[model samples]
Target: MSVRESTFPGVGALRQTGRLFALAASVVRLTFKRPFQKREFVEQFWFIASVTILPTALVSIPFGAVIALQVGSLTKQLGAQSFTGGASVLAVIQQASPLIVALLISGAGGSAICADIGSRTIREEMDAMEVMGVSPVQRLIVPRVLAAMLVAVLLNGLVSVVGVLGGYFFNVIMQGGTPGAYLASFSALAQLPDLYISELKALIFGFIAGVVAAYRGLNPGKGPKGVGDAVNQSVVITFLLLFFVNLVLTAIYLQIVPAKGS
Candidate 1:
């Protein structure tokens, strides 16, 4: 490549990075600035929670049940029935909750935000905010980002609890596992660290969703076609980022934190 051409790519990448950092910093600062806006916060919080709960509950419950069934069958063959709870609980806590809910937000909630903002951008509503001396980052971006993180944490907690309960209920109530034993095994093996890691994943993944959606919407080219394109691109990129970040976070969590009592 010619020097000028190569420099163009580097410059573009640097500009993108700078914009991303600026948005993230703005989001963090704005989240704390008007912290007493309880009414606004509660409205946004409800919107977020409503978006996340159904999917996490629906997906994780059956997922945990099926996971227990599979693990239980295998362990039964090896005369290690009690370990089913351990396997089911660990998998749900470590992988299912944040991963599944992140995907849901990527498609469901994230896409909605993208489309909403993209429409506003197309209509010049964002420009209006700019004209009025409102920082779009503070007014538009911060609440949603904070809400996403809050919703993610809530969804992760709900999923983990519901999934384990569903697994236990399914195994004991329908699949011939003893109820007391299953509960005992689950409680014995599941620790706070497993839950903590999942919460961390949710928080980070939520932030990624917010930033990815906002970045795509806020930087669209122009016009109706641009809005449509931004929405499509936003969904694809948000999904990709969610999965990629999930993998990296999982790796870091595993490396930095030893197993419970290990």
Candidate 2:
């Protein structure tokens, strides 16, 4: 491919990303305006949570189990088996919770949002609302964004709890780890700030996923294929942004939150 052809997609992606950010900012501004859609927000909250919670629980268990197995094996080899709980718990809270929550938000909630809005767009329902002076961003997008944030934070906590439990069970039962040591050292290496940072990460990821899905849905091209493409792109874009944002947040947290007992 020629240089121009290869670079075109990159340029287009940057432009689309800019538009996504602008749409997110618009939703945020609309959120503070009058006539808050409290009903819609509540409905969306329930919907997103219903779809996300079970999947998150299923994923969190295996996630913690695998981590515990790996950490336990290495710690045993080094005669530091007692630290397995602390290590596994910290890993779940600091890394797994946010990441898993983000993935579910993007995959489950984001796709649903994209498909819902995309259908509205394709049917010109959004345009009809616009003609009636109903701001779609305020009436629809803002509530979904807020719902995603709320569900994400709650899901992160759920994931953390389940992950810790899974780790405990695996380490103590399957791996022959001491139950007392696991429980005693569970929080030994974790600081309060770690929990705060993990929640913050989940909040940010949810907001990003919601906004991107809304943007893609709102701006879909003509035809059913366009809606499908928008949904696909929404998931892909959310995943990309989620990982990048997680990396940046992790770095910032490390700088701001000192290690436990430090």
* Top candidate, metric lDDT: 2
- Span of ten consecutive residues with least summed lDDT in model 1: 1-10
Which parts of model 2 have CA positions greater than 4 angstroms off?
1-11
lDDT of 1 by residue, 122-202 (tens): 677777877787777777777777777888888888888898888888777766888777767777877888888899998
The sequence of per-residue lDDT tens digits that candidate 2 reaches over residues 1-262 is 0011112134576776676677877888988999999999999999999999999999999999999999999999999999999999999999999999989988999999999998888888887887898888889999999999999999999999999999999999999999999977776787788899999999999999999888888877668887888899889989988989999999988898888888
Candidate 1 backbone collisions, by pair = none
* RMSD versus native structure for model 2: 4.6
Number of clashes recorded per candidate: 0, 0
Give the local distance difference test score of model 2: 0.88
Off-target runs (Cα >4 Å) in candidate 1 are 1-18, 34-40
| Superposed Cα deviation of residue 252, candidate 1 (Å) | 2.4
Deviation of model 1 at 212, angstroms: 1.0
How high a TM-score does candidate 2 get?
0.93
